[model samples]
Target: MNLLEAEKFPFQQTRFTRTSDIQTIIKLFSQFSKEELMKKNQEVSIAGRMTGKRMFFADLTDQSETIQLKFSSENKKFAELDNGDIIGVVRGIVCRTDTQEKKNERKLSVEVEEFSLLSKCLRPIPSSYYGLSDTEERFRNRPLDFIVNKQKKEIFFLRHQVIKNIRQFLEEKKFIEIETPILVSEASGAQAKPFITHHNKLHRDFYLRIATEIPLKKLLVGGFEKIYEIGRIFRNEGIDARHNPEFTTIEVYQAYENAEYMMNLTEELFHYLAEKVFEKEKFTFNSHNISLQKPFRRLSMIEAIKEHINIDFAKINGLEEACQLAQKFNLKLEKFQKTVGHVILAFFEKFVEKNLIQPTFIYDYPVEVSPLAKSKPENEEIADRFELYIGGLEFANGYSELNDPTEQKKRFEEQSKQKELGNEEIASFDKEFLEALEYGMPPAGGLGIGIDRLIMLLTGQNSIKEVIAFPQLKNKEKNFE
Candidate 1:
């Protein structure tokens, strides 16, 4: 049959009920299962690819269903029907069944009487017993993976469920979902490198957004009290099991809400998704079980570091001393440590982060590392920021957004100094974003959740690739030793 013709094939309008045309239905397949014929002597039409064929005592037996299809073909024409052919139009008596002759296994057999070829297969399918195993090939050709692997298909389906549930929950909360510019003049908002593209006609450089935080905040300034975006973000960074150059993130901004409220929202979102998606009220990470019954753990940055390693970062002498302590903890130290705050963050990441197995909010990070978060009321040196981590993976980050243009300008200047000192990832000041801040954005709570990482955690996938349809890989031509 022509491929296009097969696509346009109309229904035959044939219906085979149990008590009608029993002989005609039984003869459809080469073989039938005992249970196949045990259906109360009913006439049924079953169609599928022809798989196995055999001949016993001059009787052509086709193993289509559980029972052996014993039929008389003078030249053994049924055996010539190649594997994968869609052939079935059988009439058989439905009888209560068992395979007594075949002692190895028990199967119901259908007594096929007459058969017809609905469609013939010119080629055979891949062995169902041994499936496509090459990981890269499977991803590159995902349709084949879906055809052969039920588990692989289910993974993506679960991913879809996770995203859909999240969207529905946010929508029910009356947050207006918005789409912001993926291509922007300046890559402000988060401290990450962006992919630069040029507009030939405009002769200007545009960048893929590193985070939706800034644009959503801009909308907040524009009088939209609650806004959110589930967008694709690009970061020019190293690819790892946890990090991808191109990833998905959900950013939300709620005006008049503080970092504390954002933290609660984050926790509730996770718990809601977990219960609805995984159908579980508890999650186990690294053999440590956590009950998702209600509220999660809340730990300050200092408190976390203090609990993990008895160090009071608040009491540290200065930058030099903090640097020395960071060095002692085996954290990477670059050229200069202008702020002790950087060292404090580096230490917590190295010593304390890997131990936070259950859901915990590590908050009040040093201001130097959190340029976009508002400073704490009692302490100018600490910013009101919180990061949620579970399964030793950082899932979400939230904060009371810094809306003071003057303070933001100072932060940008500090970041510019670091850039001058050669930190490539420090973001450039977007004049437009600053102008938006000057227009007076509300004291809003903003969130950035790594959708890929969250999917990985929820799906029990350890690597980013398991969740991502495609992940970044190093160019084979690039030389690195």
Candidate 2:
């Protein structure tokens, strides 16, 4: 029958007296003989999608369980069924299949007495035999992908468990989960371009948030001691294996804490996640075995650059000197990267980031790149910031937040200058955020972890799109071939 006729049928009003899962029923009667099963007279109602059929027998599956259905030749209802059809069997007897080759190798099956069609399938499902191997098709048609591929379905199930464990861990530490606005007048949190939309009523352009940092910190100023927000962030950027325009991030903030405290907390949290998810402190990702057992290695940005490129950035006297060094290393420079701090960052990105293969905290970022981070007291040009890297991918960024209103204002002004110089990723000056800082916000430590990349690492998936459900894809015109 067609789907329309199946929907109009009276099967919706019909109820089964008792039903057990196919796998459960099979396990319960695996050792029972045919005479024993008949003597006990246990009956059950079971339903599943028909996967295979022969002359007088059929195979049905629900989720990951499968069972064989035996029917008499006179059963007209069983004769008319097709593969992929959903059907229910009533008062089916459980019996062991006949096997003369081995005494202990008998299989359990169901004997259907009365049956009814619950639904009809119009199209055949994509099968492993026919090959559902296209990556684009798998991502675009996630429901079908899950139905066909057991491993892909398991990954998403693990994703759910990962988020649950993270929430449990945070709540155990008394961290209050909170939400911030996704639409804002200004996206001042991070150095990323925001997606803009026009409000019809207000006749003003609003931005989708690029980061949850500013609002979460504002909550800290509003008397909350510890707070976190797990939400979607949008950045008008290019997409790659490691980057997506839309992504999930968990931004955490704690008052009366420094960057070092945040680093330790991050390590602890990762360790906890590793042990809970993988049942060990060491897990393999993309062929690399990573260890969360030891303390994550820590190195200053300047020291890392020195170790990788044999150049002491401290000796670079001025912007002209840094520019000369960049030219010497054949590094490409952006228009706004003329300052010494900017040049150091460019060099670090080109020469230092990939060398950090294991879990390492690369700290002491240049002040130019870290607008919201507090500057180091001994070296004013460096900020007390650390970025966690695993298998050469950045997983977390945390820093001692800059609470001085005057310094923050100056940094905002500098960012405004960068914006004027056509730096689209630089955030515009946010007067309201500076005003909140003016209200004497306490010293704090804040962190933003890329949830998708973390999942990819934990699940051994290499691409960010593999971990994200319904990741953005390029638009294509229909060919209708």
Q: What TM-scores do the predictions have? A: 0.78, 0.89
How high a TM-score does candidate 1 get? 0.78
RMSD of each: 7.0, 3.5
lDDT tens digits, residue span 49-136, model 1 = 4444545211121222223344455634465455455555456433333345666554334445666555555554454447778876
Runs of candidate 1 exceeding 4 Å displacement: 1-126, 284-291, 475-481
User: Candidate 2 versus the native: TM-score?
Assistant: 0.89
Worst lDDT run of 10 residues, candidate 2, spans 1-10
lDDT score for candidate 2 against the true structure:
0.85
Consecutive 10-residue window with the lowest summed lDDT within model 1: 56-65
lDDT of 2 by residue, 1-481 (tens): 4444543363464654447888788778877887798787778899878877778888877764788888988987676677777788866888766655688665577888887787666677765345468898988888667656667777887898888888888899899999999989998799998899999999999999999999898998899988999899999988788899999999889999989989998998898888887787876776788887878999998999999989998888888899999999999888887899888889888988877888999999999999999998998988999999988889999999999999999999998888888899998689899899888899999998999998998898988888888888766565332
For model 1, what is the error of residue 53's alpha carbon versus the real structure, in angstroms, after optimal superposition?
10
